[model samples]
Every structure is written in C-alpha cells, then in structure tokens.
Target: MARIGITGHSNLTAASAPLVREALVTQLSLHHDRLIGVTCLARGADQIFARAVLDVGGSFEVVLPAADYRDRKVKPDNAAAFDELIGKASQVRTMPFEESNRDAYMAASEHVLSSVDAMLAVWDGRPSGGRGGTGDVVQAARERGIPVTVVWPEGAERE
Candidate 1:
C-alpha cells in the first residue's frame, strides 16, 4: 500500500478539485489499499482530500504545522464534521512553528511527503501567492521521485 498526498491552490473561490479528489479516492481504493494522509489546512485541496480519504477505508492523518488547531480557522458549515475527521485520523503530527520561515514549510512539507507514495496536484495553473505555492510543492514531489497527477479546472492552462 502506498500513501498519496495532494497539493493545490489555497483560498480559492472556484472549486473543481473536490470532484477530482472524490474520483481519486475511488481510483485509489480500486488500485491500492494504501493509507491516505492529508494536510488539514482547510484551504483549497486539503479539505477535499481529507474528506475523500475518510470516505474510503484508508487511514487518514493530518500533518498540522502547530500544536493547536486554533490556527486553523474554518468557515465551512460542517466545521464540526471537519473537527470530527481530524480527531479520527490515524496519526496527527505538528511542528509548532511560530515564525513563517522556509524551514517551517520544509519541515511541515517533509512530514507530509514522508508518509506519501505519490502526489495529486490540483493547481490553478498559475503562480500561487507566497513561497508555499502548490506548483513549487509539486516540483518538490517530483524531486522526491513521487508520481504526480495534476488536475486543473476547465479553461485552466495545462502542461
């Protein structure tokens, strides 16, 4: 079994990745019994991936970047459901980084990557804001030799 991680745009107004993630969940289940761990950032791709992982029988893990979930602010109506999912995760890891530094991103990302066998990138096909862009993360996944599947919305550029 091989774990699969996901990367994509955060703070999005349009959503096509959710459907893609649900499909991936089905694909993963049909192909492998691998554990599914996702960063519970509650942004673009994180929420959908976590839900899909939960939908299947695969183990779910949340690699948070802090000791408290307070830093994770969620506006979803199913806030309770989100909390419930994280609580049910097989493992929960946090780095407890106060400053937004490169080391923090690397440590958190490394933790996420360590448990994964492949990556599913749901990008907008554009330059994401900040250093923690999904594109950069996908590149890192490639560097780590993980197979990647990039899913973009309709009309979004493809490579």
Candidate 2:
C-alpha cells in the first residue's frame, strides 16, 4: 500500500484546475487499490487530491488544522465540497487548537507528513506567501526525507 499526502495552493486559476486534477488522478492511479491519501482537506489542492484519490479507488484521511477550521476557514463557496470530502474520509483528525491559524495549519501538515510515504505538492515553484503555505509544507516534507512530487502540469497556473 502507498500512503501519500498532499500540500497545494488554494488559489489555482479555473483553467488550471482540470490540469491539476488530471495529474493528481494519474499519479494516484499508480497505487491502485492499495492507495491511501492524506490531506488537510483545504479548498484547492487538498480537495482536488481527495477527489482524485477516491476516483482512483483509494481511501483518504483528513487532518484538520483546528476545531474551528470548518466554520472559520472554509468559505461558503467551498463548504459543500469540504463537507462531502469530510464525509468520505476514512479518518479525520483535528489538531489541538481551538481556532484555525498558521501554526495550527503547519502542525496539521506535520501530522500528515509523519504518516505518509510521499507528498504531492500542487505548487507553482514560488516561495510561500505566509507561514504555513504550500512551500512550507513541501519544505518540511523534504527536510524529513519524504519524497515529494510537484504536480504543476504544463498549463497549471495560480489565480
């Protein structure tokens, strides 16, 4: 079985979404029936990864940053998808923070890194814009000697 984690940008352009999703599906398919995806279940890359994992017959686990993440961080536009993905997760873990913040997000990403064999980063090769952004997660995974695959398809662009 292959257990993979995901970290990615939340502001991918609409035209790039399909390209990223296709790439994720292709990568997840390699693990086939024994695939297990680990993610924070955030809006962009995480949600896309979760869907791809399920599409490839894999079960995914969620690592929530904080107790109030769903209410505070998950915007209304993305709430339905988040709820559906949460419902489909094989396991859901929340960090010990009452509020969602950068520290909590980093901690949750660390938690995901600790259990996964590999990490998939849907990034654009840019530096992180904030404390717990995609670059930080990818860097943390690399520092921990976890294999990371950057899945920025040819035409993938950030918003």
**The best candidate in terms of TM-score:** 2
Q: Residue-wise lDDT of candidate 2 within 34-145, one digit each (tens)?
A: 9999999998899999999988889999999999999999999999999999999999999999999999999999999999999999999999999999999999999999
Write the residue-wise lDDT of candidate 1 on 94-130 in tens digits.
7777654555655677777777878777776666466
Q: lDDT of each structure?
A: 0.66, 0.94
**What TM-score number comes out for model 1?**
0.77
**Model 2 lDDT, full chain set:** 0.94
Q: Can you tell me which runs of candidate 1 are displaced by over 4 Å?
A: 14-18, 72-81, 99-103, 153-159
Which portions of model 2 show Cα errors greater than 4 Å? none
RMSD of each: 3.6, 0.8
